[model samples]
Target chain A: MRDIVCEILSNKEVGENIFEMVLLADRVDDIQGGQFVNIQLPNKEMLLRRPFCLCDFDEVNKTFTICYAVVGEGTKVLSGLAVGQQLKATLPLGNGFLLSGKYNKIMLIGGGMGSAVLPAIARRNKDVECVCYLGFANKGKVVLEEKLREVCSKVVVATDDGSYGESGFVTNIAKADLDSLGVDAIFCCGPEVMYRAIKKTFADVNIPIFVSLEQRMGCGIGACLVCNCKIEREGKQGYYRVCKDGPVFELKEVVL
Target chain B: MQRRTSIRVERGGIVSNLKVNIAGVEFKNPIITASGTFGFGREFNNFYPLSDLGGICTKGLTLMPRDGNPAPRIAETKSGIINSVGLQNPGIEHYLATDDKWLAEQDTVVIANIAGASLDDYIAMGEKINESNAQMVELNISCPNVKAGGMAFGVLPASVEQVTRAVKNVCKKPVITKLSPNVSCIADNAKAAQNGGADGISLINTLSAMAVNYKTRKPILFNNNGGLSGACVKPVALKMVWDCYNAVDIPIIGLGGITSYTDVLEFMICGARAVQVGTYNFTEPMGASQIAKDLENYVKEQDMDINDLVGSLILNK
Candidate 1:
C-alpha cells in the first residue's frame, strides 16, 4: 500500500491530554466509527502505530477527525501537528461498531478520550433515543460536552475531582440515569479501570452492553500479537485480535 | 538509478511462490510477522492489504489474563526497541470468543503464540489452542522480565525440556517453541526442544536489555527492563539460528530485526526454513510485503533451485 500524505485541517487541544485532529483526505471512503487511522509521529525513531477511534466523518467536506491523548511520542507529534501540514496516514482500518435497528433507547457512556468515539456511535444510530454520560478527572479534562449534547436526548457529565458536573464516577451517574430513563442498550469506551467499573455496576442492568478496548498495537492490523484479547464462550476459550474483531465488543463477549 | 543487486544468490532462486509449505502447513510467503510485533493480523491490514504477506504470529497469550507490567514497557536504543509488555493479553478464552470470525476470513496464515507462568498454564492454554483453527502454536518461553516463568524456563535446559514436554502432551498441532537468546547455549536449548518432541523451533525471541534516561537518571522503560530487538540483533539472531540449525533436525523459523531480503537470505543460508519479520514492521509499515516482493525478484535473479538453498548452507571444514 502506498502511504499518502494528507493535509491537516486542524489540531487543537480539546481537553486534558486530549486532542482533536481534523485531516483533509479526499480518498477516504467507507470509513466507519470503530475504524482507526494511523499517523506518523514527528520523531521517525518511534515507529509504532497509534490507534485512534474515528471520531467523526464528513464526506461533503472530505474531512475526518480523530481524538487522542498525549500518552506517548506518537501523540506528542499528533498534538503538535499544525494546520495545512502534510501527514502520512493509513485511514479507516479495522471493523467498525456494529449497528442494528432492533434497539431503541440507547445509552452512550464514555470516560476520558473514550468519549472520542461516542459521537460517531450516536451518529450511526441517530434514530434511537440516545442518552450520554461522560466522565473526566475534572473540568480541565472535559471535552465534547456541547457536541455530545447536540446528538443525544440527555447528557450527564461526571468528574472525580468535582471541578465540574456531578462529583463521582460516571458509571454511578449512568446507573441512576438508566434506572430512571430505562435504556435498551449501553455503549461505552474508556480506560481499563472505568471499563471494569462499568462492567461490574451494569452486571444486573440486563441490556446489551458494548465496550471499546484500548490495546497497544504494532501493525494496526492482525499481523502482530501485541493486541490479542482473550475470549470464552460456550465452554471454549481462545485469543481474539482486538485490532480486527474489535476495538468495540459486546461487554458479555469480552473477558474483562 | 541502477537497481541494487538482489539478496538471493542461492540455489532456491527467487521465491516465486513466496508461498511455502512448512511441516504440512501452507503460508502465502516465507515472510511472517513475529509475535509481539504484528498484534493480531488486523492492525497492519489497515495500512496494507495482508494478502501481500505470508503469515502472522500473534502476541503471546496466557492461560489466565494478565495486565502486564507497569508503565514504560518500551524503550528505544539505536535501531532497536526493548519491551516488557509483560504478556498483557485478555487470557485465551477472551481471544477466541471475540476475534474468531475475523481471523478465519483472512488470506494469510494465523499462528497463535502461547505464553505461560507455570507448566499448567502452558498445558491448559495449549489444550485450548489445539481445539481452535489456528495453524500452529508458538510456545513463548523466552520473555525475560517476568519472575514466575517466562525467561527462567527458557534459560535452563531442564526447564525447557519439562515445559516443552508438558505442552506437547496436549497440543496436537505443530508446536513451534520460541527459544530465548539470553541462555548460555543456544544449541543446547534447541536440542532440548527437539528432545521434548517439538515439531519445529523459532530462534532468538528477544535479548534482555536496559536503557538509562539522562535527565531523570532512571531506566527508560517503566518496567525498568525489556527485550532488545531490531537491526542490531539480526547478526546475533542469525548466528544463533545457524547454531541451532546444526544442532537440530527439525525446521527453524528465524526472527529478530529482519527488515530486508538480505537478512532473510542470511537466516536461510544459516538454516532457517522460514523467517519472521519483527521490529522492522514498526518502521516500515509494509515491510513484510516489500521484503516478500524483493525476495521474489532476488530468487528469480539467482536462478538457483529452492531445494539447493533450503537448509543447504555449508560451513568451512
Candidate 2:
C-alpha cells in the first residue's frame, strides 16, 4: 500500500446520514473491489485514521469514490469537507473479495452503508449473472441502487418498513429466492446481527458464502493485532486479523 | 508589487554519523522499531527498506503459539491507543524456521523480544533464541506469570531480577530486559536488571490504562485494561528513562510514544543510546525512516556528532 494525498473532487449527500465522495488521486492501480482505504482526518484531535471501503475506482481519471455515513465525530469532519480539500490516505489495504471463482450465478447482499462495496463487485463481474440484494431501513435510506443496476443482472431492494421494494428484511426476502435461483456463490456485508441471521438462514444451503467484516481498529495494518476475528481451522478455533488476513472471509471459515 | 525570497546555501562538509553502540552490539543508526509494532519487519518493509533501520525488535514471542485476546482488543484515547494484543505469535520454532532466515539476512541488528509465563519459560525461550541469528534478546517481563497468579514479573524488583538472571544464565547473546511502566519504582527495576547481569535496558512498555463505554457502562477492551502508548505517554517515558539513566550504567534504549526527530534527540539527551518508534508507526508507515533522515539533517545543522548529544541535557542545579 502507498500513502498519497487525495484531492476531494466532490462530496455530496446521497441519502439520509450518508455521503458519496470522489477523490482525485495519482495512484489508483490494482485496487480491488472489497479493499478499503484508511483516511487520516484533518483534525489533529482525532489521532486514529478512519477506514472506508472502496465504492468505485476510475482507472482512466486516477480517481476513486468512497461512500460513508456520518456516524461519529470523525465522519462528521469528513462530511464537512469541501471540494479541493486534500486527504492523506493509505489505499488498497486488506485482502479484498476473490472474484475469480467459477460461480455462474452470484448473489450479492448488502445491508445499509455496506452497500458501498457491492457496486464494485457487480462491476468486476459484469459478464456473470449477478443478483443484488440491498436492504435499508426505509425508502430514504436507500443508496447506490441505480449504480448497482448498471452492472448487476438483477437488483432487489428491500426495506424493513416496506416503504420501498419489499416488506421484510433482505435476508427474509432473499431466503425463498436463494433456493430456486440456482446461485452458486453468495457475498454479504452488513451488521453483525444480520450476519448471524444470514449464517443461520444459509447454514443448510451448500453455497460458498463470503462476508466483509467491520471492527474498530487502531492501526489499519496488521501490526497492532487488535482487530481480530475468530475463525475455525481443522475443527479448532483461531483468531485472524480483520485488517490483514481479511476484511473478507468465507462464511464457514469465520466463527461470526 | 514584487516579492523576493532569500535562499540559504551550505558547504556540505559535515558528515554526521548516526551509528550507536548499545551494550556490545553496534547499530548503523539509533532508530529501532519497538516490539509488537514492527511485526518481524515484513509489513513495514513493503513501505520502505528494513535494512535502513538501525534495529528491529520482533513482535513479542512466546514458548507456544498464542491466539491472543478476543475481539475489541483496542480502543482510542486522547492521544494514545490501548491494546490488549497479549503478544500473539507463532511461537519460537515457527519463528526460527520461517521469520529468522529473512531477519538474519537484513543489514540491521535484530533484537528478539520474548515473553513467558514462568521463569523456566523465559529461560527456555532465551536459550532457543540465543542459538538463533538474533543480535540480542529482550526479555519482556510485562507478561503475567500464570504460576504467580497473573502478577507480572516486571511489577516487582525481586521477580524482575530473578527472571533476568535466570534467562541471562542460559542466553549467550546480550540480554536487554524490557521493563514495564506499571511498577512504582522504575529505577529500582532498571538497577535490578543491571544487578542480574543484563546487558541493557529498554523502557517504558505501555502503561496500564482503561477506557469505558459510558453508554453501555462497560469497558471497551476485551481484557478490560490494556497497555496505553502514543504521544500521551511521552512525558512519563522520558522521566523513567532519565531515572534509569542516573540509576544504572548499562546502555538504555528508551521508547514510548516517540514520533519525531526532536523526540529522538530528547531521548538521547536524557541518556538513551537509542530510541524505538512505536505508535507513530501506525500513523505513518515510514515515520522511523523519515525521522532518521531528519535527525541526520539536524546533526549537520548543529555541526555536532549525534553521539555528543547523549546525556547532554542541562538541568537547573
Best by lDDT: 2
Docking class for model 1 is incorrect
How well is each residue in B1-317 modelled by candidate 2, as lDDT tens digits? 11111111254444566788987899988999999988888888888888888999999999899989887888888888898987889899999999998988988899999999998899899889976899999999998899989999999999999999999999999999999999889999999999999999999999999999899999999889999999899999999999999999999999998889999999999989899999888878778889988887887777666776677778999
Fnat for candidate 2 (0 to 1): 0.65
* Per-residue accuracy of model 1 over A1-256 as CA lDDT, tens digit each: 2355778889888777788888888665577656777666656556565667878877788887888889756678778777888876766666777666777888889998889898876766677878999999999999988878877889999999999999999998888778888788888888888877877888788878888886666555555444657566676766566766777788887776
lDDT of 1 by residue, B1-317 (tens): 22112344344334434456667888766888888777676656766777777788877887778767654556667667787777777778877887655766778778899987777778898899976677888899864424453447888888888888899999988888999999999999999999998989997888989999777899977678778988889989988998998899888899987879988888888888789998888766777888988888877776543334556677789
Against the native chain B, each candidate's TM-score is 0.90, 0.94
Top model number, DockQ: 2
| Model 2, docking class | medium
Error of 2 at B7 (Å): 34
Which 10-residue window in model 2 chain A sums to the lowest lDDT?
A120-129
Candidate 2 chain B weakest ten by summed lDDT: B1-10
